[model samples]
Target: MTSVSLVAPGDAPLTLPVAAAPAPARVPTARRYLMCEPRHFAVEYRINPWMDPEQPVDVELAVRQWRELKGVYEALGHRVDVVEPAPGLPDMVFAANSGTVVGGRVLGSRFRAPQRAPEAEHFRRWFEANGYPGVVMPERINEAEGDFTWTGRYLLAGTGFRTDPAAHAEAQEALGVPVVSLRLVDPRYYHLDTALFVLAEDLVAYYPQAFSPGSREVLAGLFPDAVLADERDAACLGLNAVSDGRNVVLPLEARGLAAEVERRGFTAVPVDISELRKSGGGPKCCTLEIRD
Candidate 1:
């Protein structure tokens, strides 16, 4: 009965179907996640638009915020596993870029930036050392979970930024899953996870302006009722929020996004990870979902 205004890549308005399907049941399942301590976190170089070398970083505050984010997972009945943060590798704290894990198989990371390239090997070792079987590292550049998002059915792969187009095929081959490629044009929403994330198996929330016209149409067709975030939410890195189907954990500054999810029959749990965002990361960036 209610009208939903959907936006294409260029901010073109697209209305929802007159007769929409019934809302699905919201089920919160426990998750197993991998995170890195912000012990060595800092903004030494500018890789993304959110990063600024001029602005100083407070390691103490970053650690505190990161701890709080980890705490949020614990409170949600989710298992939080930590990988040691190596010295000199500052952005390692954003562990979600490490790689993708689905059905106990991993498609490892191959970073685009030289500054963050070493992070891939470090993450690869963690997977192999931690009982996760054969971790296949793609030769082509890919940011792993950062650009490849598992939507429970298909892998929404991203390109035109960090991940290379060839990596999508490698992921499909390595992980034995279907991948849908989405091109990102905006520098701010460099990673697909930053511009969009699955709220449930059949649903996702995204910022349309970050995608191309064709990619936006593909998303609109796939998720008709996907939550659309406003400029305010995107600015706060709100679409980077992580959802366990029922609980959505996002940045506290993402107030508009929190309200949107809450209205859509989901619990919005906001955390203050502002210190981490200084390096172009939020809740989802720091947390890597390990689906087994």
Candidate 2:
């Protein structure tokens, strides 16, 4: 009564099996790092007067102050990654500021100051020992100490002061993540973090003068809840604090910033880093927190 016939399609079509959605990647957890005892940049102003008063830093005190700061991070339940001091490399002592940690990889950076070149080696060894992806030293480009920032989702590469455009591009390419290159017109505004810090994905702390008008507009649009830190507060370690995912470690001078941080329900812990600031660095500059 009823006959059913199956017929192939008139035209042959090539088809591939649909790939199952990749398992959602596990978000890396935030882990803190402690650098080796502080070492001086060997500037004459820092050196002893009898020997060389012009040294830019006082090594003995810097080392002690560094350790104190390191202890604070430890108290926050973050793991510490330490590097031993190198003999010939003076700047190697400031390892945290030299490189950017992207995901599981640590991209060794090239420095603007020729004297800081030796700093890369120590970072290489540290990354290797910790079972992190191999360190990639960006070739054909040089990045300065203030060139980079690992702001959770994206890496910010500041161009002009210590990092050139080429260096920023290389870091972005090697990391395989998006990078935003900010044009820094003012030499004093060396790093993006110097004038801007991401307090939350939608919130930021910034100084208007630090960014160009275009960048400022972009930042304001992206972070509508941004709390603008007064210039005086910014100069006083306000912008140099760290947000441990949820809470923040504030600098003592950032009184205004701290008040806002607390209002937002973040635990704002004020740290005294007068010693580090003397060298033009602060809390954020002292530690590199690698999120795993």
User: Per-residue lDDT tens digits of candidate 2, residues 179-198?
Assistant: 77777666556666667776
Model 2 CA lDDT for position 237: 50
Candidate 1 structure quality by residue, lDDT tens digits, 1-292: 6678888787879888566655556899999999999998889999999999899899999999899889999999999999999999999999999989999998889888999999989989999899976999899998988998999999999999899999999999998999999999999999998999999987899999999999999999999989999899998898888999999999898888888888788999999988899988999999898988
The TM-score values for the models, in the order shown, are 0.92, 0.79
Candidate number of the best TM-score: 1
lDDT of 2: 0.65
Q: What TM-score number comes out for model 1?
A: 0.92
All models: lDDT?
0.91, 0.65
RMSD (Å) of each candidate, 1 decimal: 7.4, 14.4
| Poorly placed runs, candidate 1 (over 4 Å) | 1-25
Which consecutive 10 residues in model 2 have the weakest lDDT in total?
44-53
Identify the runs in model 2 with alpha carbons over 4 angstroms from their true place. 1-30, 39-41, 45-57, 140-145
